[model samples]
Target: MPARRQAPVTSHIWASGGRHLWPSGEASALQSHERGHLVYAASGVLAVHTERGTSIVPANRIAWTPARFAHHHRAHGDTDMRIVFLAPSLARLVPAHPTVFLATDLAREVLLALTGPRNSDYDQSARSRLSRVLVGELREAQEQPLQLPEPHDDRLQALAQLLYENPGDNTSLAEHGRHIGASARTLSRLFHDELGMTFYEWRTQLRIYHALVLLAEGRDATQTAFACGWANPSHFIAAFTAIIGTTPGRYRTN
Candidate 1:
């Protein structure tokens, strides 16, 4: 998510789960599993990119990827990623699509236990029980607004790429429309119909995504605010807190 760094992406796989240690910017190859799985960032942050959208997984959130959905993962900082694959029966309890969920204390503990290095210590019955508890915990947790939905239209895709490439770009939607050969009114309709949000709302989410990455990289709130196109740091803090459920400074500390 930030500048790419040279560090090996180390993965340890077992029967039902595994753990990965990735350096900042380390990314996994695009691939899909036969089973749905939950991914949690024990440290740092992970951006799970799929055709549907990108779900940002911070320490306080967990991401679910449905079976066979092509996706990849990128670390925003030195990240310890824990993953636990679910059997069809267990997966049915969660959403069928890729989603980010608020991680309660119980859910976090369950995730860590499922993917811990000594997971082998748990027998089959014990593992299955833990898996059930983990899924049950997540099933009740609230879905988070950490996902940035991707647009399908070619014009919208182009515009999205432009903003993605430079999140600090302050160009208005109308100006972006002209540059992409579409009228602002047309783009607005497409956004509402296809993406279910206004241009400004989508842009704000995109900026929040970038802000999370910047914060993960240890940047201060003020710096991350400006880097993500917020002219006023206070406004950025408010927007971030509203969506992320925590202020940037507190988020960093946590």
Candidate 2:
């Protein structure tokens, strides 16, 4: 028999859920708020970028960035972004680094209840109980590798920023390194040490990450493939599926 999908465990955690909306391609300025928060994309996809890495938060995913972690957010498609500030105690339940969590059904319902229309039905005590449950559920939730770690070396940083800005560029790492005044060997070493991945692997991850944004903007697979520097649609599909756990065709941004 096939395995059944488990329903999301319901609970609540946010001391305050501040809701906001973003049109496709809109992004917040790089920032560091005083409080930590859980960011949820109820209708679209979002990318949360910090010093550590970029976390992709799709409709099925939630992103948690700790307090004072300088970060920015970008929307894919038209996003209904929801935020819940965490108290220091509740924030402890999430990791210090940015992370992506699968949004389960129960969690979604709980989030809507807490953050959506005011619930006169639930008094302060009920809401508090719900918050604890939500936090606990998120704490135990499995994390996804929807994050792309950032590089630190000057040359590598240049390369990463270049790729991030123009993911469709077909420049090879060795070629990029040469233009940046570094040898392929040195660049490879930097990538492995600083970013913990090979040049090719890192580029693949970056391309796929960009592909998510493009696809979420409702771009077709072939167009997205070209945009992400994948010459072949079949190759692009395989890479996106391997990294994102889904085929690009079904990876809805809208």
Candidate 3:
């Protein structure tokens, strides 16, 4: 198992937060909070893992975990992670479930200010105002398709683990079905019904998740592309950009 990153201490108040430095591959233990919170990676990538699936939080995005959702954090590189707990009043503004939102310039600045060293200088009212602004910015920001939802069906779960264990596996749904005792059409239907996505779409998300971890570990775009099962680097780049809002090469630099 990877070493654990320093977990955010539990806080039930509005705008309570601090920054933590995490080395590559570090992870936090699974836990839930009484209050909803936001996580931002000032640098590197943070993967927020829950039973539902994982949400990728790169520098340009922020991830929200609703109250009582069991989750863990994993650092993909030398990560500067910031956390901010929202009081119920502010939390009510966001979605009831986990989500990833684009970190606009204003939102990023607000987050940094809330978690930065100067946070201690603010009084409760000032902090509350800033927290509201942060939430407002997020309200205006676009929700990202960075989440990989897990499947609940037995065969789908088994198949998910198989592909997860080896993201480079390029086997078609037919081959997977043959190995797992289900027909290709059956598996396709299960994927759509249980996971709300096609097999290929889900596989692309899994591959991109793997690609992110590889790129965070300093792997180049071409190497990460092939390793994650993309035969053509151009396709990999396009897919990565579409989901992550940046090229793999560019993501590596920031």
lDDT of each: 0.90, 0.77, 0.87
Per-residue C-alpha lDDT of model 3 across residues 80-121, encoded as one tens digit per residue: 889999999999999998999999999999999888878888
List ranges where model 3 is wrong by over 4 Å.
Answer: 1-15
Greater TM-score among 2 and 3 belongs to: 3
Off by over 4 Å in 1: 1-7
lDDT of 2 by residue, 1-254 (tens): 01122222223333476566777767776789777887888877788888887888877777888889998887777778888777777787778877888777777677767677674567878776776777777877788768788787899888887877787888887799888999989999998898888988888877877777777777899999988888889999998887776788877633
Off by over 4 Å in 2: 1-15, 118-121
The alpha-carbon deviation from the true structure for residue 26 of candidate 2, after best TM-score superposition, in angstroms, is: 2.4
TM-scores, all candidates, are 0.95, 0.84, 0.92
The alpha-carbon RMSD values of the candidates against the true structure, listed in the order shown, are 1.9, 8.2, 2.8
Top candidate (lDDT):
1
Candidate 3 structure lDDT: 0.87
Q: lDDT tens digits, residues 65-120, model 1?
A: 99999998999889999999999999988998899999999989988988987798
Q: Judged by lDDT relative to the true structure, which candidate is superior, 2 or 3?
A: 3
- Count backbone clashes in candidate 3: 0
- Backbone collisions counted per model: 0, 6, 0
**Better candidate number, 1 or 3, judged by lDDT:** 1
Best by TM-score: 1
